[model samples]
Target: MSLVKRIRDISVATLNDKIENAEDPVRFIDKYLQTQKRKLTELEKLYQQTLTHAHSVKQQFMEAESNRIKRENQAEVAVKAGEEQLAKLILLEKMQSEEKSEQYRLLYEDGKQTILELEEQIQNLKDEVQELVDKRAFYEAKIESIRLQKQLNQVNRFIEKQNYYDQSRSIDQKFSELEMQTNALREVRSNDTKTGSSFGGKLQSEVDAQFQQLKKKLEKER
Candidate 1:
């Protein structure tokens, strides 16, 4: 199939998709409503044509019925005139007229049924178009709600990030304060470590010299 045909086929297949998946469903509904109006116009035109055809068929049927009745009356008159052969001929003609009338009557009846069916179809189409309009409105509302939720989510994220930034700033300020306190305490304890390490360094030097002297004496003995 061609592209146009494919699009038309898809449009027909998912007639409701026009509303359900529409980005702007209200606009879509408006367009669909216009399309339906045009379709209704076309259906009306065809309906008028069908009605005209039915009317013509009915008129023809009436004429045939009238002819049949006239033939029967003529036949009756002929019979009363004491003309037996002519009466028989007139009766035969009357029978033919009746058959023709019956055929026309059947045609008229069939046309009437067809016209009724068309009217029903047109009504059904109109109802479906209304359903489309209602559904489009519903979906459009849903879309707006979803969009609002997404916007809310975005705003919430921004607020959360802002809160995180505020917390980080507070933590940084606390750490800086702790660092200042730690430096002050270390300055106060600096004299204590200097005195302790001075004594410790002298004791370690004496122990090392004594061990070396003992090692020398043992080597000399060996």
Candidate 2:
């Protein structure tokens, strides 16, 4: 495929979608960047070679034109010396050289145009490479930032959960202590009731004995 076409394809690729779907996004991005760099290098080499070829063709055209002019000068000198046949032969050679020079000149012009286009394409590819490099760095940093934010969120959730657990444990301990205090209070109340009943029964028995003795003393006095 043409280099420009290939670069265009790469430039318009759905890289974000590819990265999102990739199992190893970072690795995928690295590989993709490397491929682009290699393509850029190849395109640069081709551009240089095209420029060199254009220069060579231009030199060829100049040399041919120089030879054609030399031949024309020689033909004029021959005609001045009254050598018509020699002048005719040199004129014919000069025409042939002129034709060759014209052909080379046309080729050189075409080459020059091609070189200009190649240079433009090479510059475009360089710009694309630079843009991609910047994009790669931006994406890498963004991914890292997202990862850090996720980690921070996870840590925050863990801390929240731990605090909840601690509070639950504290509540449970307080409830257990309240339950023990309630039981202790019930036990103390039960003991106090039993002691009061025992004391009241003993006092009633002593009063009954005193009343019986007073009744017997009054009967004896009667």
Candidate 3:
């Protein structure tokens, strides 16, 4: 295996574990996402550089191959024209071109492989960042739900307290009404007693007058 075949792998296991075990998941996820984004940016830049280098190497290889083919044809033409020395020189150039072409070919292949690995790493980084974003959203929603529930509970307690107050007020009003009725009954009894005393005095006076008349008539008869 070529040394270029070894690409650094991106790992998110530690970050994921930290996020899962964090006391403040929201804050942890935010920081983790930012870090992942920065890493992704660096990896993307590296991938672009690798791709450019690979293209340059491929171009060089193609140029070298074309030169080799041209030199081969030139060498053949020189030999046919009875120019032995010139043909020898052209053959040497062709060999050099072949070597150069091979070297560039190897370089281009290595660059391409490196680019592939970098792309994979970049994709993984992106995936991890996206996962963190989703987690952040989930945490935000959960927090909102908790806030709403708390508000609902508070409102329920307020309503219960208001109902209790209203009931107490109602009982107080009923008690006041009962007290007023008792006072009115006492006033009526007092008025009835005064009227009965006046009627009894008038009856006693009439009886006394009738008894005196009967006694006076009996004395006259004696």
Which residue pairs in candidate 1 collide? Answer: none
- Top model by TM-score, which number? 2
Candidate 2, position 104, lDDT: 92
Which stretches of model 3 miss by more than 4 angstroms? 1-24, 81-85, 190-221
Cα-based lDDT at residue 152, candidate 3: 100
Better of 1 and 2 by lDDT: 2
Candidate 1 per-residue lDDT, tens place, 158-186, comes to: 99999999999999999999999999899
Residue 215 error for model 1, in Å? Answer: 56
Worst 10 residues of 2 by lDDT: 7-16
lDDT of predicted model 2? 0.86
Comparing 1 and 3 by TM-score, which wins?
3
The pairs that clash in candidate 3 are none
Worst 10 residues of 1 by lDDT: 1-10
Report, for every candidate in turn, its global Cα lDDT versus the true structure.
0.83, 0.86, 0.86
